[model samples]
Target: MASAEGIFEGRLRELCKQCPPWYKNPSLVRLYLLLIAPMMTTTAWGFDNALTNGLQSIDTFMNNFGNPQGSTLGFFGASMSVGGIIGCIVGGPLNDRFGRRPLISGGALLIVGMVIMQTFSSNFGMFTGGKLLLGFGAFIQQCAASVLVVELVHPKQREALSSFFNTNIYIGFIIGAWITFGTFRMTSQWSWKLPCILQLALPAYQVVMVWFCPESPRWLISKGRIEEGRQILIKYHGNGVEDEIVRVEMEEIMAGIEADKTMIKANWQGLKTVLGTKGNRHRLWICIVTAVGSQALGGSFVAAYLPQILDQVGLTSSKDKTLINGMMTIVNWLTAIIAAFVIPKVKRRTMFLFATAGMTASFIIWTALTAEYVKHGHKGLGIGVVVIIFIYNFFTSMCWVPLVIAYPLENVTTKQRAIFFAITLFSINVSAFCSSYLNPVGLAAIGWRYYLPQCCFNALMIVIIYFTFVETKGLTLEEIAIIYDGKESFEEAVHYVSMELNAKHSEAVSHVEEHTEVKA
Candidate 1:
């Protein structure tokens, strides 16, 4: 019988010789899906509890302020974003220095503590403080979980599996919304508080569950702990498949480490590294632009204020509005699940194009119907607005959520991944902060005209994507690195395996011709 290393080496040679280089191994994909499941559930709880249904629960708190002031509610809403930004900025360096498991475990515990406090808070100050803490935990998990996923998987499967984090978020949102809406009708305050308390269970479960999982193999390799990284991979995959996966991973790791050694270090080096080079600059700009576009499309605004928005559309009865909002959450989850499956099979650019186009059309219809209701007092127009809202969210699940996470990962190297994760999370949170404050103010100032700007944003996004975005459906991390480095064209980068095969064939033909002439 062949030794494990011998078997692995033989298989790898066959794979390199026979299969396309960019094809993702199935085992890596399954591992990502499994590991990300709990993290997604926890992260999703933050939004579902605070943004989606919790905002409506706090309406009484907002109303009691005796003015149309969303300042306090906005503060509470934006607090999480602020905490998330801080978390991302700090968590990146910490993950780089310490490791993924410590951060994940610590952040989960923090979230559980903060969420319990949020549930029991009797005053605004206490409630907002709890939110801040919750935000800190959420952001920590966001940065750690995403970067860990990227580090754990191969380059080809990285984007697809990372996209699952967002998919799970929507799924959690659906579950949180259902729980909030179902319970809210029974009693007002407890309805929201119950959901917040329920979130505690998730992190508590993670603290225990994550202990069973190993540290990221990539992080281990990056720290010059190759033997340790191999051990963890063996433990994670078991002896049967471990040797093959480790060989493949080690090759990729050594390449990345060697490349990273040439990079210059300085103050704000992460920022400079991303923006100084032409390729890095272009990628940085794309991430920022896409992030801003995604936020301005009002997906978060719609989510945060869904129950209230439902009420505005003439579903005034609390019970009815809650039920409809719950239904919308379910629909959002189902559609997002579809997108998760669809993303790997289709081009990233293609998904964004279809999603943005559909979202733009939905917003236009919604804006028109909302205007009709406000102007002419038509009841039927309100129904149309509600239907359009559903369409907007469904398309949103298909496009913005997945791409926002996946594209950023695609554009940066492992050395820049942590820093870029921080920047992307910061942009997302900042936009969310502004949106949380602005949505209510916009609703007060121009009614449904808030959605009109979003329509325009979506239209602009379609243009941006058409001109600037590159398709990254089937490329390996090395190939992606080459594309982002401007060392190769997108087409050439994606079809690199084919190029290699042709070169090898040509070499073989030359050798055979030379042999025939010598024999003659």
Candidate 2:
């Protein structure tokens, strides 16, 4: 029998070698489009971030909300995350119970209702309440959808496609930024209302269309509908042929499910079992750190508070701030899209390390430029600050943007995936909540010094990522288990399953040959 690593690599290459490229395969192309919708569920989160950031700069919005500042403003910013925290706690158990599609569709349906409520809010409490519910629904869909994208795609396309998943948030960023920029000059409440209503676009589409997509095969197999799971693999991953690679994958998934049967129970006991082992604990740690670092490492500072960051550098015109936000969205999307394509070509750990280190350096320089602009009142220095912000975004989009979801999803079991994702999002929302709640207060109170702490946080992220993050590039979701679980524990199952499947395949082929000879 081949070594576990050797078997994984050989099977992965066989899948790649036999299958036509995605564009050349009609089934793969269809599968890709279906996968993209779940991926696009993330855009709702991005739209809200950009929408609120833009709303902060609009007089009409501020006036409508009574010019919220300090804690009120912090509450407005943090409310969605507050919803996200509660939603995440429930999302995992529900996903395990009902499957991924229900959460994907149901959460989007909920977001559409919440968006309508927020769009027509009569007062501050109404708007904040709407946003809190919006966060609640968004995280539920996001938790399930992120896992579905990782599971549904053919393994040959899994790395690039899964990496492509979170980057769709940039599409939402572009839409929200440009929408707010277009509406920033309006004198009516529609300036904010229009953006809120438009947040419904992606979620509404997801709600209506998600049913058309297939349920995750991993979820199906875990539910003991093994033949149903095998058929999905043959159609999507095998392109209608019972390809060897597809057979191998089905076996691997079955083996993983069998190994994890004890951990697949209902309620809190299921979650307790997730952290019962050292490997799973390490997986949880990476998920938590990635979630927290994605928000705390100076990226959220600019994403949620770009207007204020620009104000510190002496550009106070709402028009200029909105326009710059729009432009930065374009730069970020362009960079993140490029990174998505490049993800399959590099090590996961290396990408995180490089992105965090670069972001730290960029934040340090950004702080210096902001300080100079504030002191000397130099227009050139202010422009330099703007340039540095863009540079920081470029570094962030390069790796962190794409790997945030992909890394954590690749590291855990399907049984534990939704739970781990919940934990990750819990950390993310908490970090985001802190960033959103504190950024306005910190920026207003300490000015440029607010960035000083972010710079320190970014540096610390680099250290933690280096010590804890593992490389998962080019490994199957099942094969990656060997990295955390012992090879004996993980590979033995794959090897045994592989031999059984291969023997059956050979026997079937020999029988077909004999029947053909007899007919001739």
Candidate 3:
């Protein structure tokens, strides 16, 4: 029998032969539309970043919030990170038990109320409390929605869609940035509140529309609802036909589940399984590195403190700061979208290495430019800092912006994805919390020097990713197992699929020959 690796390659070729592109099919068009519900949830994250950055530039917002600075500003920024940490802990175990749709829809429902509370807040306590709760709901949605996109999407579209998924954060950022820009002129708290209200759009869509999207087929099959899972594959993946590609996909999914059965489900035993072997341990390491490195690499600095960074560089005008924030977000969004679409056409490891290296170089230059501007009070130097900021973002937008979720998903098995992703989110929250909480304090205390650590951290990441990261380009979630499992993991299932296809081909050839003989 051919090895699992050879069979997977053959299966892929066969799938391509049998299936049309998603754009050519009506069922696929509708399915992609439904995916929008989950995909848009990242906007909540992006919106919050832009909203806070914009609010800091507004004079009324400063007066209303008592001119928050130092530790107070740090906590205000970090509140969501704290809430996200809690959400990951609460939502991770329940994800496997309740399925993806409920967590996704329920999280959106929760955010709807939180957005309302945040929008109408009259005091710091009320506003921060609302933010904390909003983070809770958003992270819950993030944990499940990301998993659903990878599992439910047609395999042919998986890499592009999954990579594009994180870029949705930029969509939210764009909305939040522009809204804050439009509102900062108001004399009342309504300036900030208005942007908070606009956040309701995507979450509201998620609450209602996710119900219309199909449940993850892999989730269904894991629960023994095999026919329901098969039907989903037939409908979405096979374009409503029970074709050979669908059969092969089902067999592969089943084989993945069977291989994973030796591992424990959820809690401590699952954690042990994730770390029990060299391969699994490596996965955990990459997950942590991806989670923490993505945030700690100066992106969070710009996201949370761009207004302050602008102030140090001599562009203290609120209008100037907000405008730069809005424009930068647009550029970042476009870059991320382009990178996402290009993911399938390029190698994952190469993108990470390039993004991290470029970011490190951009940030180091950014630091020098900032120091020069602060020292000489030169507007030209400050402008150089601004330009470098965009350059830094371009590098991040190219890789970490899209792959942060997708690459980590590639590292673990389907069964352990929920638990492992929860762990990954935990690292993200911790790193993000450090960035959110400490960035303000550090900026206030050390000014331009604070950017130095991020530069160093980013430099280290380039090395780590180059040395440890594996290429996952053009592979399915199940096919990736062969990388760690030594090409022997799914041999039995591959053999079965091979034999089944061969038998069908032979039977069809026999029927054709019989028909020709009769006609003769």
Considering summed lDDT, which 10 consecutive residues are worst modelled in model 2?
1-10
Better of 1 and 2 by lDDT: 2
> For candidate 2, what is the lDDT?
0.86
RMSD to the hidden true structure, all candidates: 8.8, 2.8, 4.1
1-520, model 3: which lDDT tens digit per residue? 1223564656755676567778898888989999999998788988887887888988888898799888888888888888899999977778888999999989999899999998788888889899988899999998899999999988888889999999999988888888888988988878877888888888988898999999999989988898899899899877789887788788788777766633646578756776777777777888899999888988888999898899898899989999999999999999999998998899999888888888889999999999988889989999999999999999989999899999999878878788788888889989999999999999999999988888788878888988899888877788777676655557775676557656876998999999999999
Overlapping backbone residue pairs in candidate 1 total: 0
Candidate 3 lDDT score at position 509? 95
Better of 1 and 3 by lDDT: 3
Clashes of each: 0, 0, 0
Query: Model 1, which residues run further than 4 Å from truth?
Result: 1-38, 45-68, 154-159, 234-245, 261-271, 486-520
Q: What is the lDDT of residue 126 in candidate 3?
A: 89
TM-score of 1: 0.83
Q: Give the lDDT of residue 179 in candidate 2.
A: 90
Candidate 3 lDDT (Cα, 0 to 1) = 0.86
